[model samples]
Target: MDPSRTLVLNTIIKEKAVFTLFQPIYDLAKRQILGFEALSRGMSGSLLESPDKLFAIASKQERLSELEIICREAAIKQFVSLNLPGKLFLNVSPKALLDPSHPKGETRHLTEVYGLDPKRVVIEVTEQDKVDDANLLLTTITHYRELGFQIAIDDLGAGYSGLRKWSELCPDYVKVDRYFIDHCDQSVVKREFLKSIIELAKATSTQVIAEGIERMEELKLIEQLGIVNAQGFLLAKPTRKPPTELALLKSLHSEVRSSVNQFEQSMAIGWLAKEANAIHECTQCIDAHRLFEQDRKLTSLAVVNDAREPVGLLHRDQLTEVFAAPYGHALFDKKSVIKLMDKQPLVVDEQQELDTVSKQITDHEFDIRRHIIITRDGRYLGLAPLRDILKHITEEKIRHAQHANPLTMLPGNVAINEAIEQRLRSHHDFSLAYIDLNHFKQFNDLYGYASGDSVIKLLAEVTVDVCAQSSSFVGHIGGDDFMVVFDNNDAEVLCHEIITQFELKSKAFFTPEHVSAGGYWATNREGQKQFVPLLTLSIGLVRPDLQHCINSHQVAALATDAKKEAKRYRNSYLFVCNRRKPTVSTVRLENAG
Candidate 1:
């Protein structure tokens, strides 16, 4: 290190010139801010402005412990002054934490002085240097936990002993490195890595926070992978004073509500939500206890903030356990319910789908007896009993099974019609593609009924696979016909991919000689010997006019007409009936080989 830089560092540390910026970490399911990760930096426009440089210089100067303490103090002081509503995640380097000269109980003392609850502070153990003493680290972490501070492993996958440290620490949160989250939507390997981490987190009862998610696709994939908490520039950037309310979060909630609106009432979790009273987070434990005592049927109560947003959950049993203890009433009755409530209770949006919510509950390993908190736009709505949700999901599954095609297990005509009608009822602009196999009867005649069934199943798989990336609904229309209802505008692109994939996969069903010939001799429907083209898919897409389309029947008729138009092509084809307006009937055709 330069002597001049060392002098500057000494002055910086002596004056405690470090400052902190907070980036909000969001709970995607609850659509609320869970906490803020405190990022410390040096004086702006200085050589040590970057945290990396500041920390590297500190380490080189052998004053890492002192510098870390200074940074922590700055973060905690600002966090309290700003009156941030969520947990404050302070970065604690393992090296500093393990330093022999590092002052013990300093963090607890800081929180006490600032009148901040130690429980609201999460010591994020950063992976900057290798840890040589595992037992010492565990003991130090235990000391923090005893002081009511939560533990989190930062940059989890970027460290030398990430898994080892995680096992040893069993931290409350593990922040997955940005490398695994970057472009995770496009990388199967990264997705698998995230899946493994999520599964491990679930098994261990540890929450995983995906860090550095800068893209919308990354955020979507993280949510799809069942990660509830996330931190990244995509959500919010680090600032001196972070906004409590996020417009992006509200927009995301609106999108979720809109998606759920597309489904029928029976399919959404909102219908299962029962009216339940909520207690303010500031309500005393004694008052909450009395409320529970009055209602024998009430098992739990949602704890909400002044804005009616759910902050936690208070269980009757938990309160009962506390009061049942010796002098428990004297010890805790006057304390706020927030002190006794489950801060990480399973809270879900009311607009979430039943199946999606079910998966979330199961993935989180939530007990069925502990009711889930339901919210609409982050505001308290009601409680949904897990038993009722399971029962509804089971019933829906059975109903769906009955309405599913026996051949491919895809949704059958009843479900298909319902889907179309539901879309039309909601006035959602969607495209319905009627798909048919060209020369299927002749191919079946030559290959036999078993081969014909196989071909139909193949088409179902292809269509479903191609549309899997989107919110499209693929249904089996029976025999050689299939249907895909595209909720997104990429129907044409998906159609082309389906045609290409089916053509490639279907070649396995034909003999090499017949495949090379590209045609087979079969008796025609008129009982005349004729050459029939190899099996090919004919897709007819029709965008139903929201204003003109009255029902699924009309949409089906239009799709069928378009399919007839597509059959005019001798090869695999997609024929689109562009219903841009009620008065216009434009046709577009594309052949796929």
Candidate 2:
């Protein structure tokens, strides 16, 4: 990314320079070797072997021909040496492919010398050098595809116009960028973004692979997000020898499914559950008083109507008058619940929006004050005394609030990841959700610098406050968005809760004028009615099994991958679940070096 590195890439391109360094890509589920992505490192020191610098240089300079040839040759040479049944992803400059001379005769030469299958030799049009002419790039890529070479769009999510570029190029494979993977579990915002990417890849029918997975946490996050192809140190460091074990592959596949189960349990969280007919009804005032004795005073009962449908609520005080008049136990027990029931009680579920809870508390409508519990099916199951549930939720809130976002107080990326990690580590089944906001720049441009900060803080506070009682965690990764951890096992209910809360709270961020205008209205530094930008969120959720995981780091990685899918899927959300770990059950995976 520095000027000097750019110079090196430029020099390498002009000079026909390329050196081959191998990075291992593995199949954790199959425990088989996929192959390597041949990387190009320049000769110059200080700037040499630096991927960022090389990319910047290529983008800045127009001389991409020399670089392309070198990269192809290097990949071919390595592929020939291995002579294995795997693909070699060679990074090629899109600019160079525009010229007829570049790919001509190159196909036969690569196969003849390197023994690589034309179909397996993937030409990755990397983001290092973007496509200036969409038509030209597509035509050039099509030409190579005709020659039996596979096409890949590399580092798509990491760039400014990755989606646009992908649309134009239509590559067979998409490699997500690394920055999004880093610290993914902690920042819900990012997980949302990454999950979008995965969905997009699926829709396009393009295989998605993640690169630069350094830590175990990151890998677990990615796997849980439903990504099957992985390349990172957590799987295995790049080396001369290929992987020879099958256990790795099986482990990888299993871990994905198990993680999902944990998330479901967390979402359906309950200390106790039972049938509606388990309790007796009160008829007399004396009977009500007896039911209210000592520790029993706070019980709230579910009252059903004649047809066995739950129609109202029942509490001890409502029947106190009958209890004082006292009758036989038979009279009291046989009485219908309707007489003592408080008809309009608040009903909620395992997946109720945390913010809805917040709103009810804020309004302080005493009759509606009692919290009712519903099954995953939204059926009335039991009642939650506000005092106790709130006490527990308050503790979670204190913990959640204690960890503030670095840029905004909503909650930092670290806190988000930690909550997910804690849940996954406990192996009780939970989800790590990633939330990322899309197209935030226009807001900054119109509202100026000061207002942008307000937008970010507003998002953080709202997301955090909304998830207060369900023990759902909210974390702000950075910049414009936030994340939420929904632990319910019922996928439908969990997704519903988040979407409902986000839609409602988002309204508060916009002004009345902006809301009516069909877009938002923000003042510029000079104070103008700048058009409000499109506001959307991408979400990815992953659940990793702790018992099978190597360590916390692995779970963190899985969370990050889920985030990548969020971004790729067009500002939407994705869910990835793991059944088991893909590698050995070591507590931690250490760097090979």
Per-model TM against the reference? 0.74, 0.40
Query: Stretches of candidate 2 above 4 Å error?
Result: 1-18, 43-63, 99-103, 239-593
lDDT of 2 at 248: 49
Clashes of each: 0, 92
> How would you encode candidate 2's per-residue C-alpha lDDT over 395-480 as one tens digit per residue?
66676677675566565655655666666656556555656665567656655777667666666665555554344556676666
Q: lDDT by residue for model 1 over 72-127, one digit each (tens)?
A: 88998999999998899999987888899999999999998888999899999986
Candidate 1 Cα misplacement greater than 4 A, ranges: 1-24, 32-57, 65-88, 94-122, 127-208, 212-227, 232-261, 321-328, 423-431, 447-451, 465-472, 486-497, 504-517, 521-529, 543-551, 576-593
What global local distance difference test value does model 1 have? 0.86
lDDT per prediction? 0.86, 0.60
Highest-scoring model, lDDT: 1
